[model samples]
Target: MSIRAVDLFCGAGGLTYGLQEAGIDVRAGFDIESECRHPYTENNSDVDFVEGDLSDDVSNAEIEEYLSAGEDDYTLIAGCAPCQPYSTMSNGNKNRTEDHEKWGLMDEFAEIVADIQPDLVTMENVPQVQKHDPYDDFCRRLAEAGYHISDRVVDCPNYGVPQQRKRMVLLASKHGRIELQDPTHDPDEVTVESEFSKHNFCELEAGETSDDDFLHNARGLSDTNKKRIRHSQPGGTWKDWPEELLLKCHKKDSGRKYIAPYGRMEWNKPAPTITTQFYNYGSGRFGHPEEDRAISVREGATLQTFPSDYSFVQSEEELSVKSVGKLIGNAVPVRLAEAIGQSLIQHIRNEDPQTQLQTV
Candidate 1:
């Protein structure tokens, strides 16, 4: 029998699409955002989408009704709970006790697994999560529940993602111990220049995309910013900026430490981790290697390992660059997810049904 899966917090179906690519039967996806419905359904036509708040309790009835669309196959429940609360990037808001609701969602995910007793479970999140109490508690609870688990923090470039994103992945099974797939490619093998060339994207100027693809078109820059980028060198920081073009903040002692913003990406290196505002040159090291504009939406998606045809918007009216950037940046890289799926399949195939049933 084929393994079947459901993705919780399934933003734009990155994990779902990837598991499907690895031959897992992904029957449904659940997320709080309604915007996810179209992209998740459109890309995986056979998959159902359920929208609801993950911060609240997800009852057994709701899980069975909305997510359990498959039959008596080996079941997998996968989720990447929102990482913003645990992310170092959002540490400024660390004191906000009320907003910790997002962190509580992971406990809810654990509760669901305890109730449903799925054959397998998986979770992906920022590496910083391991330092906190919640992550440690989740692991302890799962171990106590009789699940054999393995987890490690991994660099995305090792898994064939063309960006320098590091994440912690957990793979647990009631049947037996399982671990994620090893690196398929070294960091140098999947550099930005090499990956772009593979997809037919050559050197581009301001606001230009390949003639064959409009999605590759970059966000246009203002005259001042265009001049700033022209002076910026690939892999260079804000110090390279002319005195007049430099921001007053960059002149301050504290600001000199923060050079990632308004920096240009190197063609020969993996891109800096793609973020929700990646289309804006002012956000992190998102500037094009040589072009006088930020990386395009399609470029961000490609770096996230999303396929060429993965649709983010339906029409021009719906195409807000910031909104699309958030969806792509927040996704688990598709290639990394595929590697996890393949490992899970191997683990399941190796298990003896008689021994697996004893865990339940």
Candidate 2:
């Protein structure tokens, strides 16, 4: 009676990892990028990683082979199609049409769900995607397929993730009504003290190590940027920079409203949404609270709710800041996904007390 799951568009197995953590049997992950193969397989052993573009035709035989591999009575199909096309960040750009090719991926996901008709279905994406026509079409299709659907934009911090991120989550069940559970943490509850005070080395200086092998690394800073962060305070924006260090863009009216870049995260609060360029101090508020450099790969993974030892870059030659940054930032926060998995578990148990999932 345990649910068997196949993750579509699974990046670095964040959702798969969380599902496994929540007692679901995640059998495989499907992704287009060849880079995901190593990390996905390495982190979640025994789960097959299928590398193929979802936008193209993904045959039912391929998905069924993985899903049916397990002897479970219930099945779950989860996908978080690429959200860049429907992102508000791309809203006003004239070249938005250029991303039209990617928008069809949602439709592709819908098509698969309709064809498979799994016992349960779930999807997570940027909140902005909620307003798009494709999402509406997807929901309508699910309704037509007789799904009991529930969905809402969820704040990540509410689910115990120590980051300010908002994502739209959708849950649909053919068995019964199900919705995500209420918030586990109050908005005012997550503080710098709660997240950082445990280590004793709360104030990490640039290139400083807490002597913990896993957290011993961070992105190094240039000498000039190092001096800039020295002037930057916790939770303070780039505007706090000394007048002598002002960049050319900062003087412009358009750039004044964008203050997160080069800003330092406050220790007592949830970090800002981690992004693909998070390794660069110039991108968003990535600077370590007391350090002169941007957060390290380990710190980025930590903020994303990845376990301390979760491997993103496997080999020394494959270790590039940009590639690993994308994998971490684009990951479904593990804590949030665990909450979703817990909800599904509860829903299944409520609907059928006699049916118990087999544990791996």
- Judging by TM-score against the true structure, name the best candidate: 2
Q: Write the per-residue lDDT of candidate 1 for residues 1-360, one digit (tens) a residue.
A: 567778999999999888888888777788988788888898875888888875464555666554454354678889899898888877767675336668787887888888777888999999988887778888888888899999999998899998888999999999877888778888788888877776766566766756666567787778888878888889888788789998888889978888888789998999999888888888889998877788888888999999887888786567777778888989989999999888888787677644332111
- Clash list (residue pairs), candidate 1: none
Q: 259, model 2: CA deviation in Å?
A: 1.2
**TM-score, predicted candidate 2 vs. hidden true structure:** 0.93
Per-model C-alpha RMSD: 3.3, 2.3
For each candidate, what TM-score against the reference? 0.92, 0.93
**Positional deviation of residue 20's Cα in model 2 after best superposition, in angstroms:** 0.7
Q: What are the per-residue Cα lDDT tens digits for candidate 2 across 1-360? A: 578889999999899898888888888899998788888999996899888876565686789777774454788999789888877677777488456678899988998999888889999999988878899999999999999999989988898888888999999999889999899888676654465553333345566545554343566677889878888888887777788888888899998888888988888789999888887787888888776778777777877888877887765556776788888888998988988898888888888887766655
